[model samples]
Target: MFKRIITLVILVPVAIVLILLSVANRQTVTLAFNPFEPSDPVLSQSAPLFVFLFAALMLGMIIGSLATWFNQGKHRSRARNKAQEAVKWHSEADRQKAKATELARSSTLPPPAESAPRG
Candidate 1:
């Protein structure tokens, strides 16, 4: 229930802003790919202003994500090392537990006599 509320709270505002951006930037704009040929463009295409805006937004997000990931390389490395160490410790513990069980079974013990019911 709390998750749903949080999702709605964040989603509603973002959806409204994106819708407004798309509506406001609906004008058609031409993009020229051929920078050398300024007078006679060999490659050019017209797109909606919203397309450019969305493209820029997507590009910025991708760059930011990559930069963040790259910057946290040390943290990732540390996490991996810690996980490996945990696995090693767990295996050692399991081996010790098995050895203990084996030693307990190896010990000579007399069987218990049957007890009569008191009831």
Candidate 2:
């Protein structure tokens, strides 16, 4: 519930701002990829300014996500290795426990014969 409230607080304003920005910048603009030609380009696109802004935003998010994932590779590897080691240690402990239990069972002495109570 707290998380939802926080998300609403943050996202609602961002959404409103993005909506306003898109509405305000609805004019069509041409994006040229060719640096050689000033007026005409081989690779170009005409779209709303918001479209480019949103595309760039999405691209940046994707790039940042990839970079973060790549940067944490070592930490992820270490966590995996530690998990495997923990499993190995746990299994070893279980095996030792079972062996000890078996030893205790096998080494147990028989019950003494019953005797009458003396005054």
Candidate 3:
């Protein structure tokens, strides 16, 4: 459920952008980075540039979110390991307690005579 909501949140903005772009019919100007002169015809336009920059920004945001998600995965694994260790320790303690009880009962019995009767 939570995953579905997060997916929707991410997609909503992208959908809105596409809708807006389709509705508007305007040209965009883009700056060309060259020492001599602007050559590329596509770079000479402005509308495409705005869309390109917005797309880049959105891509960066998605990448950052993925990085955070992977980091959280590491912490989650650490927590799981600790929980397993705790369970193992509890079982070991129970086993030791049982062994101690058995030993105590056995020790209560009388011991055989260590030496024969003296002359």
Task: Give the top-scoring candidate (lDDT).
Answer: 2
Tens digits of per-residue lDDT, candidate 2, 61-94, equal 9999999999999999999999999999999999
Candidate 1, residues 19-89, lDDT tens digits: the string is 99999989898777788875454587688988988898999999999999999999999999999999999
List TM-scores for all candidates, in order.
0.73, 0.90, 0.38
The list of candidate 2 runs beyond 4 A from truth reads 116-119
Each prediction's whole-model lDDT (CA)? 0.91, 0.96, 0.81
Q: Which ten residues in a row are the worst by lDDT in model 1?
A: 37-46
| Candidate order (TM-score) | 2, 1, 3
Which window of 10 residues has the lowest lDDT sum in candidate 3?
A: 41-50
What's model 3's lDDT at 42?
Answer: 51
lDDT of 3 at 87: 100
lDDT of predicted model 1: 0.91
Candidate 3 regions off by >4 Å? 1-14, 25-28, 31-50, 86-119
Q: By lDDT, is 1 or 2 better?
A: 2
Give the TM-score comparing model 2 with the true structure, all chains together: 0.90
Candidate 2 lDDT trough over 10 residues, lowest sum: 33-42
Best by TM-score: 2
lDDT of the structure predicted as candidate 3:
0.81
